[model samples]
Target: MTNMDTLWLAPALVCYALSAVIFIAGRLTRTSRASGWAIYLLGAGVIFHALDLTARGFQAGNIPVGNFAQALSFFAWLTALASLLLIVRLQMAVIGAYSVGVVAATLGASAIMMKGGRIVLPASLQSVWLPIHVTLAILGFSMFVLASSVSLVYLAYESQLKAKRPLGPASERPPSLEKLDRINYSLLGWGFALLSLAIITGAIWADATWGHFWSWEPVESWSLTIWILYAALLEARLTVGWRGRRAAALTIVVFLVLVGSFVGVSLIDPGKHGGWFG
Candidate 1:
């Protein structure tokens, strides 16, 4: 990484840390000022994150997706961006703590894994479809992640209500179950659409580079599994009138599958996609 890249990392870390604190404060104090601070911090982080991505692109002379570290960093920022947009729309600053934590963890992991060695892009990843596929896939994943977080929060809030307990710091100010359910559905819809687009682009890229569109590679298989899970969740929500706890539980399962696809596959069976981290 260049000096420019390293410089951006500091600002990004600071933003995430500050956002996390502000989010917690907002939830605990029920103060709009805390949420406002979170928004500011998130905006600063996004700017720095964009700068970092630009630096990487400049270094690569193309869209950079060669190694694992870059992919992780990109996905982290994508998640942060998606979460911030949702927070703005929903006015749910309570979710900021979880979202910022995810950003910080991913960024820290990427920093640890990032090697300074230059990587040559695989021939198969050179087509225009590469960018579309990656962007959509990352966006889809981000949405799913956000949905999962909201589901978890919903469950926690429900538990508190059932027990008639006082709300804790994190649970002090949360949206209603109905609102969380609606957000989850919206995220699922958006995520499913993006996932479909990603799969289509992946198929096209595969055909262009490898002469085949569907090879059932490990990464491909796992991604398909996640897609199917989310599809089922959506169907259940619409047809079965699944809501509240049931819907949140299903979303939790889907997110677990997503995590397995992202982390488990890489560890269990290294394949063409194994080079993502290195």
Candidate 2:
């Protein structure tokens, strides 16, 4: 990458690092102030990430959605942005640690992958559906990640309560169990909707470029698997009255599937989407 093209990485990494530190501090001290700082840092990181994506797009003379580094960077920014919005709307600063941790992991992986190779976009990827498909997918994935984080916290809190253990101030920082459940479902609803849109747009793009809507590419298969799992989770919640520990467990499982599709499948197969890892 050119110096100008890569300049955004410096600030992005710095902000992520700062956000991580603040998150850890907040977790350790059980203070909301540190979490607030983390939220601010995450916002700064998102801005830098946007600049980086914009620079790469200009350099490529098209949207930079074909490569792993760009996709991961975009995903990280979307997650951070979603987390920031949640914090602002729900006043739940306690989840900052988990959100920042996710961002750090994604960006760190992208940086390593970038050092290994350069991304080369294909002509087929240049289309109107590229942005639509990518944006929806990233947003859906971000919501799933957030839901997973909250589910984790819920399990931990529930365990502490069951064991009659003192969770200190940290336990008090998150919302109530009912509230957490509501938030998880809300995120699931939005995530599922976006994911459906992503799938449809991807199919349309496939048809436009390859004369077929479904080809069973490795990435496509994994994405469909994830979608099916989430769909099942939503159905269970609605039809079987799934909630509390059961719902949380199901969400955790679905989120694992989502991560597998996002990272593990890419690493293991690296099929047509291999250009993304470059």
Candidate 3:
């Protein structure tokens, strides 16, 4: 990381953090311009983030996913890009609030993880298979993060309805349950399909490199577990006529398992895939 890189990245990180704050405040106050401003700030952050990451990648001769810090920074960048896609089409500014909050939080964590240090990529991480697999993993997880945020918002709104509480000005603006549910369902399909392919590609990589496709590594085991969990959720929802509260609850649960698999297990186990960084 060069001093010049830090000079540019610092503002981007600041913008992301500011965007998170603005999103939350906008949600709370029902401020109309807050959403637009949040978008603007997020856009700036994304631009700077891309530039900074691109510079780093050019310097390193790769996309910078060799270690936990680099992986997370790359993931956060993708999540922000994904959030922009989700936010532009939806009228739900509150969803933007929820989405940016997660992105910002993740970026913050990435900053902490990277903390003026660079990763030393191992042979495995430098392989073509690693970035392809990790990119898919990040995409899958980004959907999970967005889905979970939407789910959380849906549940909160659901609770308010059940409580018969007057819609506080702040809470009045969340999207309808039907809309939220539809987004959640769509995200599940996207996340699952991509993650399934990720598993296959990962296995291929494992076989090519490790001479075996399945190591039952802790991360691999958890990835399969999460895949099955989402698969079941999708099955029950589409075929079993599952909908509403139960499905929403399951969405939240799936995200928890996802977090455990992506971050928790990586921290504790840091298997062959993660051994280079942690």
- Backbone clashes per model, in order? 3, 2, 0
Provide TM-scores for the models. Answer: 0.91, 0.91, 0.91
Instruction: Give the alpha carbon lDDT tens digit for every residue of 205-231 in model 3.
Output: 989987999999888898898999999
Sorted on lDDT, highest at the top, how do the candidates line up?
Answer: 1, 2, 3
Error of 1 at 72 (Å): 0.8
Question: Mind giving the per-residue lDDT tens digits that candidate 1 earns over 232-268?
Answer: 8889878989889999988888788788777888878
What is each predicted model's overall lDDT from 0 to 1? Answer: 0.80, 0.80, 0.80
Provide the clash count, candidate 1: 3
Model 2: how far residue 5 lies from native, Å: 2.8
- Model 3, position 158, has a per-residue lDDT of 88
